[model samples]
Target: MIRPVAVIGAGPYGLSTAAHLRARGIPVRVFGSPMVSWREHMRAGMLLKSTPVASNIDAPQPGHDLIDFCADTGERRYESDWDLVPVEIFARYGQWFADKLLPDLERVRVVSVDRAGAGRDGFELKLDSGEQFTARAVVVATGLSGLARLPRELAAATSDGLSATGPFSHAAQHRDVSRFAGQDVIVIGAGQSALENAVLMAEAGAASVRVVARSRGAVAFGDAPDRQSRLRPESPFGRAWSLYGLTYHATHVRRLPAPARHYLVRRVLGPLGAWWLRDRFTAGRIQVTDGRRVVRARVEDGRPVLTLSGGQGAGRELSADHVMAATGYRMDVAALGFLGHELRTALSVSRGAPRLDAGYGSSVPGLYFTGLAAAASFGPVMRFVCGTEYASPRVARAVEVR
Candidate 1:
């Protein structure tokens, strides 16, 4: 039997990869809800950091880009990079991309993926609906599926049963912040998600919102490009030479020493908010506390209390009605509970992420990963929508050869 190649996600990476595979005339089966994370996890007023031109799910054929989708659907398109793309528009584009190019996508959950038994050399996928299937190759494009990183203090508080109710939640856990109305919210982190969500909480009628960060440096904003500037954009992420290098030479970056590569991935696109978001977050509206870290957290008087300590001093207590941990995700293969024990144990890992080769293939042959899951090997570009341009075709070509 000629088993189909399985793409285990339906987000940007999965849709892009499936489109390329189909264009190559390779039989493929895609599983999962289309754009599930963006639809469920992201709050309604959020805008993508990427520009409209840069945010596209690449297809082998022309005219399937985000611009094409906007033009076709008449969804208020933006012509300039400075214009912020809304999350809702992007989500709709994803669904439209799937409907147009991948009509056979299966909206089903892959309960587990395990290696085929005995002499077999493929994968066995068990679905949630009591069905089983075999695939010649499996591409795990599950972006941020099991990668939510809760802070140690917050995690410990949860373990002690302090967070069983509504006093604590992760940034990725909510699609609406209005529920936090009339309450005090402590938002932790310095990144875009942290800052943006803090503003959202305040706008949603939260009595007070405070942002805490470990860095004392001024929060930076991405500079808008001058229209007539001679220096052209190298990547969709930015016009900087460094960002350009990271985007185009991602595979080369992967070949560098692991330590150096990992450091670049973590630091190159470090925490910051969009230029447009600066005005929304004012000092008068939201309090900003820098150079502080939440060392401990506990429930006191039906509220979450955080013990802050760092550059400012030691043992500062901040009590809030709720804690919104905007701490970003950390990639750990073990967190991907969908992969069976045997498959998880077989692949080599570095820094809790799967180490991939040039084609985004894992240590296990015929097993591949893309999107955020492939960021460890490919560089930071994998974390953004633009990475699909490099990842989809490259992975498809690799699978075709095999």
Candidate 2:
């Protein structure tokens, strides 16, 4: 019997890949909650950084894009290039895509994935539900799970007690932020998560919110250009020729040195607030303090106390009811606890990310990675939803169907 292909996530990448594979009549099984990251990890009512056109999940056939979703569902259309996409709407879109294209998606989580051993044809998968199965191939499309990066100081402090529950939390860990209605909060990081969530909590009736960043000056925002320029062709990521190459021609990206790829992955299209968020964030509800970093953290009286370094407030100590580390994610394949240690160690890595061939295949045969995990290999585009266009079909084509 030909074993089915297993897709280990239900995010944009996983769903798109599964759709493409299914279109080729390749049997496939997809796992994980649809748009779990966007639905559970992100703050509700938040706006996505990408515009409507840029926020699409790829499909094997046309007419399944976000624009189509809005049109078909009669949702408020965000057709303008500058319109911000709502997180809730995008999450619903993911579910709609899955219902129409992958109605058989399994909501169960994978507990572990391991090589079947010498002479075995494929890999073994153990599920959280206690079911075990085998697959001809595994596409790891788990977007941003276990990849949240907390600073060493914040991590140590959280472990001291709260550990992302009581006093310290990651930006994505705000499952019920309404509980902080009357508490003072301190947010660390300069990115969209920090700036946006601080204002969100404040609007939710937090007593006060302070956003601190370690940059030398004010935090930077990648506001859209006033008008399109003919000098550089526009790309989904931005208006840079390099972004065009990164977004559409990942084959060329694989030719770059590993360090260059890693550098681009880390520095591209990140650590900034959307243009729509600037006014709300700077409206005096939240305090923005740049050029300072959280040097140390501890709990005092069941509250988080952070020590700051640099800026005019050098060595200042601040206490807040809650501390959020919005420092963003780092792709370390080893952090994927679902992979067996031996299987993980067997894969070739470049600076904690798995190196991939042009088709998104890892060093291990029949093992593939997409989305943020593929960022270091495929450039910055892999980190966003639109990358599914460049990645999904290729990964589907790469899977050898018996």
Candidate 3:
């Protein structure tokens, strides 16, 4: 009998995982578009937090590689610098790799996954298209779609008049939001998205753009150094990179205990990239309200009013025409509807993430995870597109069937 395998979530991690398994002579069924959500949802001109080279899915093997595709087409987007890749170029790269590598993929969504047999050795995946698939093993590369987290205050205010998300939607449509010129805009959270959008709104003629951050300020650069610099301490990016390299060079990220890895991740990755967009945040006369949280948001006379509270029980009320939340995301298994009750109950969880082994397989047999969901087990790097190279191969080895 032919072995059956399914790769879920056709993003970089999922596609790459499928490609690697296919290359290893495994029969793979891949679903979803290659970078479809990223291309459609993210704003134009948004630069990636990951370097192009670090973002490759499959390790270079003879005759098949992203670099070769770029070389053939003369697409220089594959050779990006500054550790930031543009979204458009990355999308093209993914499409190119998909066309040349794995082309037989299902574009439908997997709605639910459940045990198919009495032995529970095989699994059944139900698709939104009313089709069902039984596979020996399943890899959920669905990426981070289920985890777009907004602040509780912002989430509550979204029902009110305040438009807390999609500040860039207008900008992405190339509409000049100059009508709001000199208008008040309050941005919640200090992440790169918050700062970047705040800058855009300020540039679009918002009179006063204020950013409320739980951190001290808009992130500053050189905070999380690149991996390359870590290999050599005296390199241009400096000691932070060198330290990072030294830390990961000796031991594989998989070998480290999950808790220790997560702690290291919290220290090294969290709030670090927020610094990269500091220049953009500081570009115009945008205001920074750091070390504060928005306690309440209410509409008054069609204006969004916010009550900000600081650490010492201090409070201030500010009004804005618009509020945007860039508070990042959480990965609770409950958010993933496809996971059946048995799988969800069997899998270990730390915080909101599914606990996985070194190869990114969950505690439940034959059900593996990769990319962001696997970050809790794999380390901070695993949370990024850059880490997919490591994650894809490991997952392929674990779940790929002959």
Candidate 4:
């Protein structure tokens, strides 16, 4: 019997996991579309958080890389991770790579995963199409679909007429501001998506667009790059960059103390990303309220009204035509509901993530997690495309072939 390796999710990380396993002569079964989240969640004009130089999956051959694809396509290539990428193009690239290498991948959805027994070497997987199978090992690489964290208060008070959910069209869905021609729009959060949403609203001809931030300005840990700055070599101050063999040289990326890494990420990296997006955001014709927090929201007059407060002040209320949030994500283990109680109970998690060994294997034997869910233990880099190259091989070597 061919005890295949089962991979959940067909997003970039899932596809990359499948590709790596296949290269080792492992019979891998993958579920979902390549870059499904990007196709559904991300806006069209939005660019990748990382530049071309920092984005790639682990390819068996040396030249099968993201930069090479960009060079061949005459796309703009930047040396630093600070550069932007159009969401559509990046998603297309993943599709292109997956089609070329892992054509046997299935796009069917995974409904549930269960454990047959403690002594069993494999897992029982149930698919939405009414198919069931056993795998020698199972890897969950579902990416962001499992969770879309929103403020608890916001989630409870809103309905579809005034709710936050995926597949909700952003600015890219409309060609002109005429669709929003007479509505008062409110954008929450100061991340890239929030700025992009604000721009889209203004361009869409919203009667007015109000952007609220918890911070004084959008908090980015790094500074924006000028022409001279963009030409600099890859380093901490320049933004993390990894070339063909350069990633191995950075011991910090692999061995920093958790506290130190967290501090650096909070004080340095997080602010830098916000800085890069600042200019593009300010260029828009919109209203921005700094240092305000949304404490409560309610639907009033068929529109949404928000009560906001400053760090050291009493609350004040504001209303909008519609409120949209780009507040970012949280990698909660409970998000993987498709993994039934049997399998989930067997998994150990710390701070909402599966606690894993350096090899990406979880406490449960023959079960693993990579990509976003793995970042809590591995470091922030694990959340990005760049981290895939390092994590894939560890899982490929640890899991037995079919």
**TM-scores for all predictions:** 0.96, 0.95, 0.85, 0.84
| Model 4: colliding residue pairs | 47-85, 177-204, 177-205, 220-271, 220-272, 221-270, 221-271, 221-272, 222-271, 222-272
Candidate 1, 39-106: lDDT as tens digits: 98898999998888789899999988888998999887766877888899899999999999999899
Better of 1 and 4 by TM-score: 1
A best-first ranking of the candidates according to their lDDT comes to 1, 2, 4, 3
lDDT of 2 by residue, 67-108 (tens): 888888998887677788889999999999999999999999
Off by over 4 Å in 3: 59-67, 77-80, 158-183, 223-260, 273-276, 311-313, 400-402
lDDT of 4 at 386: 76
Q: How close is candidate 4 to the true structure, as a TM-score?
A: 0.84
Instruction: Give the clashing pairs for model 1.
Output: none
Per-residue C-alpha lDDT of model 4 across residues 1-402, encoded as one tens digit per residue: 988899998877888788888888999999887887888767646666666656676676675577666676786664455666677878777887788788988989888888766777778888989999988888999887746556665665655522232212233222233456678877777766667667766766688888778889764434555532554456423434432223333224336555654443233334324355556555666788879987888877666778888866658888876677666666787878888887777788765778777668887888899887876666666667877777787778878531
lDDT tens readout by residue for model 3, 326-398: 6666668888888888878888888878877666778777888887787676666666666665677777777
Question: Which clashing pairs does model 3 show?
Answer: 182-207, 183-207, 219-275, 230-241, 230-242
Using TM-score as the measure, what is the rank order of every candidate, best first?
1, 2, 3, 4
Q: Which candidate, 2 or 3, has the higher lDDT?
A: 2
Show model 1 residue runs off by greater than 4 Å. 160-165, 227-233
Task: Evaluate model 1: give its lDDT.
Answer: 0.87
Question: Candidate 2 overall Cα lDDT vs. reference?
Answer: 0.86
How many steric overlaps are in each model, in order? 0, 0, 5, 10
